[model samples]
Target: MTHSDTDTLRAIQHTERERFIASHPRSMALARDAQQHYLFGVPLHWMRDWPSPATLFVAQAQGATLTCADGVGYADFCLGDTGAMFGHSPPALAHAIGEQAARGLTCMLPATNAAVVGGLLSKTFGLPMWQMALSASDANRFVLRWARAITARPQLLVFDGCYHGAVDDTLVDMDPLTGGTLPRASVLGQVHNHAAFTRVVPFNDLPALETALKQGDVACLLAEPALTNFGLVPPDTGFWEQARALCREHGALFVCDETHTVSTALGGYARAHRLDPDFMVVGKAVAGGLPCAVYGFTHDMAERMVQAKNAAPEGHSGIGTTLAGNALTLAVLQASLEHLHTAANYAKMLDLASVLEQGLRDRIAASGRPWTVTRLGARMELQFMSHTPRNAQDVRDHAQSELEAFTHLFMLNRGVLLTPFHSMMLVSPATTLNDVAQLLAVFDELLAALRALPARPATAPASRSA
Candidate 1:
């Protein structure tokens, strides 16, 4: 981007910020009050990451719409960053939660629905045995312990720019200079070097992955089918197939984290694509927005886990939480599996996402912007570059953070909400065509605003290999 582009983006961002503050008086007041007690004026520090002038306080959310405290209604394409990918408060899940509240919340024991949920998990995700946790982060952490225990290996492999939700082993980044793993710079309170046990490689790089796995010390290769945390860099054609084969050839377990990629299909990207991971984790939307996640594994892998446990000295495993698989979560999971994670619902989501993807592409073309859209079933990302990125390096090299901030703020000012971390849009089962149209209208308005700026020559498009 040129200096003129930067100036235009700043101008638009200023106007949008002002408009947002004016429209969200209630939210602004609440944010001011919260600042007296809450850190960063928010319950979670990351909640402050939104581009809004103040944190938008939610009054209510149902289906694909969110109403802020100031009575502003937004067509929410963020969907709680995939936590509500099936849509907020789906009737079945809401009902299940209500019923379970009266029965029992948690007793540190299995609920009546536990057996049934296990069967649903096995049938839906194509894995026979399973374990539960309070979040995908916890599940991923447990799976890493199990993989290391069973395989008796010390090292783990992960793709660069991957996020498996707060797991320490997955928090390291690739050192561009030496192609070695280094602790992520943004990570705080780190006392140990994660790179000692974690090897990082670029996504879609088969040779790098094969070389890493050939070291024979890797216990598991944990990855998403498509990287989501760093702006949705998808696997190349035949990437997972070859990666899976290489892991098997080198004795590393393949653990697919489908926390976000569950939006890809009824089961997940792993099931939809038949990647056949040794272990699979599904969270976020898995329990209908409840704080629950589950990890499943093959029968052979389960047997290995049992052997590892039996061979160990009896003690706390450091593998589960008290609230995980609680009665409330189990009931909600059953309802979500029966009602939300269906082929019919997924069909609707995919159709809507297809419409959204094409709509974005068409709008980008009309605006004459060198932007691109990448879609994975119900999820889509509007990137600032012309070509789809092959890896995290591609994204970092060409990222236009200022333009991205302007786009998000612009959309929010127009009663539309996108994922704040990136220009990601998710289509839920409850997302309607009208909601999509509202987003598109705002998007078009945003493009027109950009076009009205002083003319500047377009830069050459980046090469596909870039």
Candidate 2:
């Protein structure tokens, strides 16, 4: 881009940042005080990652709207990054949680709802057995141990740019230039070398995947149905079928993480697409925004898990935590699955997302910019590239950090919110057509402003390091 173009973008970003601060005085005050208590001026470090000049303080959130501390309401397309995907405080889940809390919270012992939840999970994900965890990260970690025990292998294979939570092993990324696995720079306090045991390959590349699996030392191929982290990268045709077949052929378990893709359907992407995964994980919205996750496996995999446990030394087994499968979590998870996570609700979400997808496409077209939108079920992302990215490297090669930041800040200032970390937006059962239209209208204005910038020759792409 030219100097004039850079100046225009910076001027727009500055104006938006000032507008946000001027409107959210209460939020800025709270953040100023919070800085003394919280390390990053927020409870969680990721909360600081939003595009706002200061961390926006939430007063309350219900359905698809969130009111900030300054009393400004926003159409919350982010939805707590999928933890609130079913919508905040759904009546059934809230009631279940309140009742369960009155009785007890955590007891290390199984609750009466355990058997019912297990059966529901089996039917939902087409798996025979289930286990619980506090989060998707825990489920992924435990499943990795089980996979290693079952396959007697030490290495775990994951596609590039895939995120399976904060699992130390899964945090490794494939170096774009060298095509070698390395620990992601974003991961902090790392004591172990994850690349030593975590094999990385590009998604949608069957030749690379086959070569990695043929090594005969992989315990499991952990992946999402699509690459969702660095914007959306939907799988190519017949990708899962061939990948699952290769996993079976190489004596490795195909572990599908549906924490994000559960929005694909009530049955999750694995069952929705008819892909046979040896193990499946569903988290985030599984318990209606509660801190809970579940992992399930096929009957054969269950038997292998039992055998592996029995054959091991009588000890911790390094699988589950004491607070896992607590009474409160089981009750809420059961309530969410039976009441909120239903086909009817998903149909509504899908319809709204379709509307959003087309609106984004129309807006992008009007701008005459080389951009594309990708969708997987109710989730969609707008990428500043000419076409959909096939892998993480492709995403990095076309990433537009400054453009993303300006767009995010502009939208947030206009009482709309997209996922701050990316250009992704999700439609929940509670998200209305009006809310989506509002977002698109704001985006249309922003695109028009961006389109006024002077065009220039292309330069080398920059990664989103921050």
| Candidate with maximal TM-score | 2
Cα lDDT tens digits, model 1, 25-107, are 99999999999999999998889888889999999999999999999999999999999999999999989989999999999
With candidate 2 superimposed using the best TM-score fit, by how many Å does residue 313's alpha carbon deviate from the native? 1.1
lDDT per prediction?
Answer: 0.90, 0.89
Q: Each candidate's TM vs. the true structure?
A: 0.97, 0.98
Predicted structure with the largest lDDT when compared to the true one: 1
Model 1 spans > 4 angstroms off = 452-466
Residue 370, model 2: Cα distance from true site in angstroms: 0.7
How far residue 198's Cα lies from its native spot in candidate 1, in Å, is 0.6
The CA root-mean-square deviation of candidate 1, after full C-alpha superposition on the true structure, stands at 2.8
